[model samples]
Target: MSDGFSSFAKLFSGYYSDKLGKRKEIATFGYVATGIFPAIIAISMSWTVVLIGRIFGWMGRGIRGPPLDAILAKSIQEKGFRKAFGMHRAGDTLGAMVGPALAFVLVIRIGIRDIIWLAMIPGISLQ
Candidate 1:
């Protein structure tokens, strides 16, 4: 459900990025906002608060995607989009793989609740 709204938000985000010529501003803000969502969820005592956090996080992720794509495309004209995006996707996949691997190791020491803080490290760097 969070992703559903996020998917919808992506369209508008892409449009606004192009329309405003502010991809850097919009995407930077999205990264910062998305980073904070997990902390919000971890801190929430009520499911309602968690739900709100999820929605905002999803929207931030959605908003971040397209402009980043556009920026990547624009920045790498020499190599062409196919190569650049391919490398970008590889890194994304690597992160996805590494995240779980790290979690699997750290979960033993930290447990799942505290693992949320681990997720925040990369997210917090976006700001």
Candidate 2:
């Protein structure tokens, strides 16, 4: 993957997501794409396909990040920006804390493929 494309895609996606005022939608789309792309990568045999999927997945993150922050800001209002951001960070860290446990469970019980499929649930529900 090219660093240039990744950076550019993320920069533009963040710009557009902000411009469009669709923060929630962007956040939901990012989640769904993340879930689906990993599955695509797992199923693919070719390196090219896996690379493309990874690139797209990163782009999907670009698509989501600003909008997710934007929504959180809006939800909390301008005066609460600091608190809102703090809450977001806290929630993110909490998720990070659980990730390893979840991965272990997936590897031992359901497998990676199932985990990928399961990931979609949050995205789909968020949407």
Candidate 3:
């Protein structure tokens, strides 16, 4: 369900990023949305709020990807594209692995809501 929103958002966001030539700003909006929404879920007491937050958060994730790639592609020289993208992908993969593991450990210690709050810290820094 969230994926549907994400998929649609990715298509439109990518189109606008190109049309506006504002990859950085669009990407920043994505990061802010992704960050803030989960924190919204943390404070909310209703399942509907959680559902809304999750859908928007996933859409934020979708919104960032293409513009980020566009920024990376623009910034790097052709000769170093492989290396640069590889490093970017590596960092993403590392985060994917580490985030859940860290959350799993933190959930046992601090609880799930706190973990979600903590997750917002890094995202906030992106802005």
Candidate 4:
């Protein structure tokens, strides 16, 4: 599953991030990958295509995790780490809640495929 690939990607991505010293670029690439891949499923006509898209999307998420955390830690002072992380987590939680709620509403109006495409808009715009 995607989790397995994600775990594999995490192990190597951390090493590459350190070597490349380009956390921002790496994270951006990861975010773009995560954003674009799942949207591929919207065009899929088969379950296999859906599976591939999901796996790649999740791997992208895993790829971004460590580098993004490193960037976050570096951006904030040591004393403010707790608050910064709290706020970051709060934003993530809000997104998690809002995304599903929006999807639930939109799915009725736009249907599942269109909703997935709509979801990609925000993800791709993160850059």
lDDT per residue for candidate 4 within 38-123, as digits (tens), equals: 78899999999999999999899889988888899999899999999999999999999998998999899989999888767756
Candidate 4 — what's its lDDT? 0.88
Q: Write the per-residue lDDT of candidate 2 for residues 1-127, one digit (tens) a residue.
A: 5345556666765787788876677777777776567766777789898788777766666667777776676677678888879888998899888976787777888787676667656656755
Clashing pairs in 3: none
Residue runs of model 3 more than 4 Å from their true location after superposition: none
Total clashes, candidate 4? 0
Could you tell which candidate, 1 or 3, scores higher by TM-score?
3
Pairs clashing within candidate 4:
none
RMSD of 3: 1.1
The residue-level lDDT of candidate 4 at 36 comes to: 92
Q: Clashes in each model (backbone N, CA, C under 3 Å)?
A: 0, 0, 0, 0
TM-score of each model, paired residue for residue: 0.90, 0.77, 0.94, 0.93
- Tens-digit lDDT track for model 3 on 27-124? 89889888888988999899999999999999998999899999999998999999999999999999999999989988999999999898788779
- Each candidate's lDDT (Cα)? 0.86, 0.72, 0.91, 0.88
Q: Is candidate 2 or candidate 3 better by TM-score?
A: 3
